[model samples]
Target: MNKKYIQCIGTFSIALPLLAAIILTGITSIVKAHLLGNFAESKNTYKTEQAQIAVLNELKIQHSKKQTQLKQWNQLLTGDSFTKVNERLRQSIADSNKTKTLQLTDAKRSTRPTYAVNAPRSACEFKLEGTFSEMQRCLTKLECRMPNLMINTMSLNSQINSNLLNLKLNYTIWENAQ
Candidate 1:
């Protein structure tokens, strides 16, 4: 009976440590899996946030470009009244005529169709006589000096026995709407 009791105590001591080791390993595995899951979830959330930030940055760049273009367009617009604009146009044409052989034969103002909803425009028809080179120089000066003036139509006819050309020019001036 004493030997049997000793054997039972040995068996119980070994089994207790083995069972404790197994239980501890199971708990460790469960904790590791939970931690790994949380890490994965956080990583996914970070990626989503980064994607949204990139999109917003792209949109911001596009908006900045649009603003710059708008500013440049505004620089090409005149805020003066139609009468003032017309006077300026005539003065410019006269100035061009003085520098070159271009002669202003006739000038007329006509009603022009508006191209923009918020911008008003004026049109003028001009008849001039000059050589081709003189006409070219005059047109170049007008275009470069007055950014608001746009040439809508131009026609040139050569005289039967002369070096001079008859030029018909239609131009439009864009003004800022009040």
Candidate 2:
């Protein structure tokens, strides 16, 4: 009886320690997986923020270019300067007309500014009846001549009974504020 009791006690001691070891291993594995998942999420977040910063820096550079262009377009708004700009615009139109045998039907010019900012702009609106190619060339020439010209709006419509297209062009040129 004494030997049997000793053997049973030895077996119980070994079995108890083995069961505790198995439970501890399972808990450790679960904790390790959770910690690794958090690390992966943090890494992804850091990368996304870095990309956004790069885009913002690029936008800042573009903003500086725009400011420099504005400075280069400063004007004193003299009568002679206005006449020159107007003559250049008319010459551009005439060249386009000669290129494609088209004519300007109606034209309007206004010194009223669309934006009431530190720099004011004069606007001209032209209505032309011609083929699409002719009107496109006209616009290209005007843009080339006046690099500071802003195309505020443009609309094209096909004439009711003819193959010709009706083009409306609204353009603005900036002037310095004194």
Candidate 3:
């Protein structure tokens, strides 16, 4: 065989694999770029959209829970449209005070064995015949131990018959909605 022909055959042998590798690399690059483009678009459009929707759903859930809590607090702070919550609280406290713990001051209202709030709902008024110290302690307990209690008015007068003082106290209590 001629040396020139043999040299040409050797060159073709080396160039064949090199050409194949280049063509295959180009095809793979094109295929990867095509698939990556679609993936990137879906990740930005569909995946992000789904995540945003989920965030909105969570926000709505939390908003509703907060709204419910707000309504309950409102009910506690203000009982109904007609009557004030503090007035009702006062009546309930007065009723509770009317128990045997306190002696009646105004015999007319005290004659009844009931604690009442006159506003078709509640009020706070009670009479206690005792030393000033006892009444003060009771007021402190109401302000501290109880959740929401407001003392509206108090009248302390010395009794002639007894050395102790006569106390006419009025307070309020707030009942919160669950």
Candidate 4:
């Protein structure tokens, strides 16, 4: 080929790979964005609604019904914006009565906890003392009921026949609809 023609062909060959790479990357990004965009339509649209509903469902799973389990679930979920879910928790707790009331303090996270994406949650620190059997029963109750009660610490001290259990129970509730 002539020098000018050869130069044009060389330039096109050199640019071709870069142009192809750019187009491929752009297409990939658009596909990714399209997948993620499916969720961010409006502030309180389908995604938010679904998240809220999931919060309720999780409450149901966590507040699985048992006497003591129900008690804590009710207390945690009550009187908040998540009241509907709390009501569901309350109803679950109403199913049992073997537990006494326990105190829970709203605790600040030293660090923002790792939580599910788009999950608006609040944390509480719960402490309670019970006899060995009672404590086991309580934990069992918690295990049965609470959907999101992350156990930070659990300690048990033996007392006579019944042991004394000092436990720190951490739980979370969704702050917003989700």
Candidate 5:
């Protein structure tokens, strides 16, 4: 009876450790599967973000170009009529201190409708005497005040002293055709 009891104890000890090892192996496999799934899902999310970033970058470039075009169109819509262009030009010249030395002449404008939109335009030619800096400032001011003024031609002649400059410019101003 003693030998039988010892044998039962040995068998119980061996079976207990084996069962525990089997349970541990099952748990390990389940944890490994869960970790692999999480890793795959993370990889997919990263790829999606990369695609979205690429699309956003493209949209940013197009948005800048469209914004510039919209600004130009808005200026065209808000620009002054033919009569105001001369005043704006004179004001710009005055601001640059070139009004006293400026010579303005009216150009031969076509009375017929030339534009597809039937927009009336006034063309004028002007000669200005000043330094390069003054001329640049004058141009800047004219552009700012009269957004729809288009300079068709510009010619510059420098004097012997190089400090004096003569600039001849041809410009056109667009007005809404009533």
Candidate 6:
């Protein structure tokens, strides 16, 4: 009876330790899985935020570029009076005719509605006879010399019996409101 009692005690001690070890291992596995899930979720959130930041940065760069372009255009605009602008326009036309391949047949000017509260607008229509190359050269010269002039429309028609092309050009200019 004494020996049997000792054997039973030994078996109980070993089994108790084994059971406790198994429970501890299960708890540790569950905790490890939970931690891994949380880590993965955090990584995804970080990536999403980084992508949004990149997009916002790109937008800022584009805005800066647009602002610079606007500044350059504002500097290019002429602030001359209407009479001075007309004189300059006549001079530009004369200068373009140095090659003798272009001729201005008619020119008309009229007041146009203000495009902005601080800027007044005027329109000009020009009828010209020239070769295509000469007309293009004249247009380029005019635009370069008069930065405030914006070409609104243009039409070209080839003459029936001549090598010259008829050109009708319409443009607008902005002036200081004051």
| TM-scores for every predicted model | 0.48, 0.48, 0.34, 0.33, 0.44, 0.48
Q: Global lDDT of each model?
A: 0.76, 0.73, 0.59, 0.53, 0.71, 0.76
In candidate 6 the C-alpha lDDT for residue 36 amounts to 91
Show where candidate 5 strays beyond 4 Å: 1-83, 98-118, 160-162
Clashing pairs in 2: none
**RMSD (CA, angstroms), candidate 4:** 18.1
For candidate 6, the per-residue lDDT at 178 reads 46
Cα lDDT tens digits, model 6, 1-178, are 5998887887788877888899999999999999999999999999999999999999999989899776756654545434544565567667777668688788777556445455567777788897888777777876776677877788999999989999987777765454
Deviation in angstroms for 169 in model 6?
1.1
- Residue 55 C-alpha lDDT in model 1: 100
Q: Which ten residues in a row have the lowest lDDT in candidate 2?
A: 72-81
**Number of backbone clashes in candidate 4:** 6
Worst 10 residues of 4 by lDDT: 102-111
Candidate 5 clash pair list: none
| Per-residue alpha-carbon lDDT of candidate 3 for residues 44-158, written as tens digits (9 for 90 to 100) | 9998899999999999999998997777556654554214433432443454553334444441111212336432223445666755555565556545444444556677889
Q: Which of the two candidates, 2 or 4, achieves a greater lDDT against the reference?
A: 2
lDDT per residue as tens, model 2, 70-175: 5544432434344555576567668777545566776778555557565656777777788877777877886775676787888989989888898887777665
Q: What CA RMSD would you report for each candidate?
A: 6.5, 9.2, 11.0, 18.1, 8.5, 6.8
Point out where model 6 deviates above 4 Å: 1-86, 111-118
Superior by TM-score: candidate 3 or candidate 5: 5
Cα lDDT tens digits, model 4, 6-113, are 887877887787899899999999998986786466545977889999999988876665657657655654445334333433443344324543222223332335
Angstrom error at residue 177, model 5:
1.0
